[model samples]
Target: MATEFEMKEIKSGDPEAARHSSMAAPQKSVTVKFENLNYSVSIKAKKTVTEKVILNNVSGMFKPGKFTAIMGNSGSGKTSLLNAGAVKGGKISGDLIINGEKMDTKFMKKMSAFVMQDDVILGTMTVREAITMSALLRLPPEIPKSEKLDRVDEIISMLRLDKAQNTVIGSTRVKGVSGGERKRTGNLIIFKIPAMAMEMVTNPSIILLDEPTSGLDSFTAYSVCTTLSDLAEQGRTVVATIHQPSSDIFLIFDDLLLLSEGRVAYYGPSSAVIDYFTKIDYPFPDYVNPADFIFMHILNNSEEAKQADKKKDALNKVLLEWDNSENKKVMLNTPATQKGLPADVMKVNASFYEQFRFLLTRAGKNVWRNALMVRARLGQAVFLGILLGLVYRDVSSRPLKSQTQALGIFLASVFEDVQVALFLAPMLIMPMMVFSGFLINNNNIPVYFNWIKYLSPIKYGFTAAAKNEFQGLVMTDQFGSLTGEKVLDDLAFTDELPVDQNLYVLLSMFIILIGMAYMALWRATKKVV
Candidate 1:
């Protein structure tokens, strides 16, 4: 019952394919086996909190040269199970082994390429640029640039993306590559069988995908599955959580692991699924797709009180049957081996300097391409500078009238700029500006409110600006004339912080604030689970 798309030429013997082919020699294989895996999270409601189990004692095996599909109804722990196996977060209790060796999540993350359901692609870059950048950053630094470029070209050809290789991987704001093409641009770490073929550079032994065909047409989904099949054929152990797939799509999978209520309903070869279910008295109807038939029986769709009970009973029965099956014993009893695969080999090959250079170049390109945003920021800076200058004008000529005004302008400018750059609200920034000792003299201000001035960067800038303008000038009121020293005493500027001291404090504040801002930006950009 294979469709035309399913039977289309697989390009298995192409030069690009041959380069990745495992048939030439028996490539190193990875076998992932999990036993008694349980995942849970604490949930709070009103005044009470409880633990919700996501995966309950789930056990299975994923072997190289096979495509294993994990499928379930909504809220059936499909994503949680995938995350438990591939990601290191949440509370998980399990025995996860790779190649008969107990492997930690960190080690697994390096050895496996996890293609998330969502496309994590740089929208600005063309298809070729995105893939090439990933290759440069990920492929061993020891490899020559030419060889890397050749690898990228080979991947581009292998994935059949030559037609749109130069097209931008656009965002919602901009039109770029087609949806199918975007789906191919997956995460860099793990082997994702997307159109970009980014993981081929690493030749990872294990590839894990979450809903690889969730947002594609039947034909595109079939093509994606075919690509995964080809990768599996080359000795990669491919595991993906698939949604309701078409009959042709189902045929592509070598093994199936179906879940119900966080418990395994079935796990076996795709070909034996119909027969297995029939033996359990859940016979398939005539001319119905096996995937659809299985979903209809396992998933709870009934709203009727009586039918709901029947569905629950049927699901429980299936779970109990799986618990008693011989397959469960075989999967849980797999022995651990002494394979020594160093976790460092899976670590990013580029040195820290190389990584920094690559990131800096990419960031520069992104900023340069967004010309409108850069120009707008520059315009704002110029306007603010001009405004500050105008407000602080004539400080020397009219020292008495403009000295305090200049101090206020400098303080406000420095404080406001820092606040805006840090994304602080005006409501929060206004209080700091008011307490900076510009409008209210620090000595005259109440004792309790005076401490706010100590924390203000504006205080340093104001003192520095006032001393620079009025240090040696003469100040006069209508009644009398006063020396700059007298004026400094009147404003409490002659006490502890001199002009040089104020300037140094302001410089320190600037450096500290800028460093904090950079750290915030770095954390924001870093990937967190």
Candidate 2:
């Protein structure tokens, strides 16, 4: 019987294996190497500030065609190491090399895919729609839409998600796909290792996952591990910070970097870890799971101060042993030299306009499918419109009292629409509307509170509505009657601005608010390293 590695080797040599490869884009080899990496964060207590070291002198290499698992106890800096290595923004000091060359943050962001633990997916979209939209946005603009869609289908089939391809990804408030499928949707490459191996639409050289098997059952965890292993076998460099994995799952990793309190306890092939510990006179008992034993041995002794000190000494011995080991000397001591990388791999294919158009189309589809949210918004708009129409019926030809009522209703409607669309909270809307000139006379407002009217959307709405309504109308007020101009003067709406000018101001505010909302959504849904 052939081992898993032997089977992978056989598959690589088989000509038929190419048939299963992705046809969407060509795959490129990526090697990620980090040396003497250290990360720290500053914390302030009262007037004094202190820097907390998160990752201390961490170093490792992730090569193409291999899966590296970083395991550690809670607060062991596994995540810190992963983040530092991704070239993301932080207080990190290290030498990070990609494909034997020092790459910039922009290159890393463009060429790599980082899948965080929490699944960030649009609940309104179906499995196919989400993946298809991602392909459209991430793939090079030169790739045809048809070809990009073919890649989506290939990824769906490769990940064994064909059954749920059209199923909606439901959220807590909505009903949709399963947790496993949701996780798969978050990382397209690992979800469909075969398709990624053949040719992914994005064609990322390196992939990083933070706790890919977290919140999964034994069987599901095993399946996820198998998929990651398959991704590594296809010549992609895969690195993941895993939680407590089962014994069977642990064996699937090609390399292991065990960390304890931001320090390396062991770093080498997974098969050699047990032997390394045994050589230090710490051997696993008969029939004991090596992964469980390793963690237990490292952390089990850290309960009391004396035991913790002893455990620290033991851990240091292992770290020192690894430092002197032949594997470490060969893998870590050699400095990486610059190598030419593929132009396509480093280039971002899509233009800003293309990304915006694709995002807009996807957002429109999401809104369309989210029937409950759509109905709610439409219902509010229609209800408010009808209510305003009834309250201010025929005010264009009515007396001053009716016209004033009409102005109030119109102002309220505008403010309400803007509030509902932008803030999405009545708590915030009510206060802003109260301070607006419609409900309270601007002259009577306190000096400090007078600034609120200028910043309030309701003030702009009321001003615009009043100007449009009373511009040239005749009114019947206390002095037997007055022109709309006189009424505007009495109400202190004497800005001398034209109706079109006020409308333009309102339109500008609306555009600004919409832009802010878009930025918020982008930040919330964006990938985190």
User: What are the TM-scores, per candidate, against the unseen true structure?
Assistant: 0.84, 0.82
Determine the C-alpha RMSD for candidate 2 after optimal superposition of all C-alphas.
5.3
Question: Which pairs of residues clash in candidate 1, taking residues 3 or more apart in a chain or in different chains?
Answer: 100-337, 113-190, 113-191, 114-190, 184-195
Q: Could you give candidate 1's per-residue lDDT for residues 4-107 as a string of tens digits? A: 12322333233243244332212366788888899997798999989999999999988778899998888889878877777545578988788777866666
- Using alpha carbons, what is the TM-score of model 1? 0.84
- Clashing pairs for model 2 are 21-198, 22-198, 22-199
Model 2's number of clashes is 3
Error of 1 at 245 (Å): 1.0
Tell me the whole-model lDDT of each prediction, alpha carbons only: 0.73, 0.71
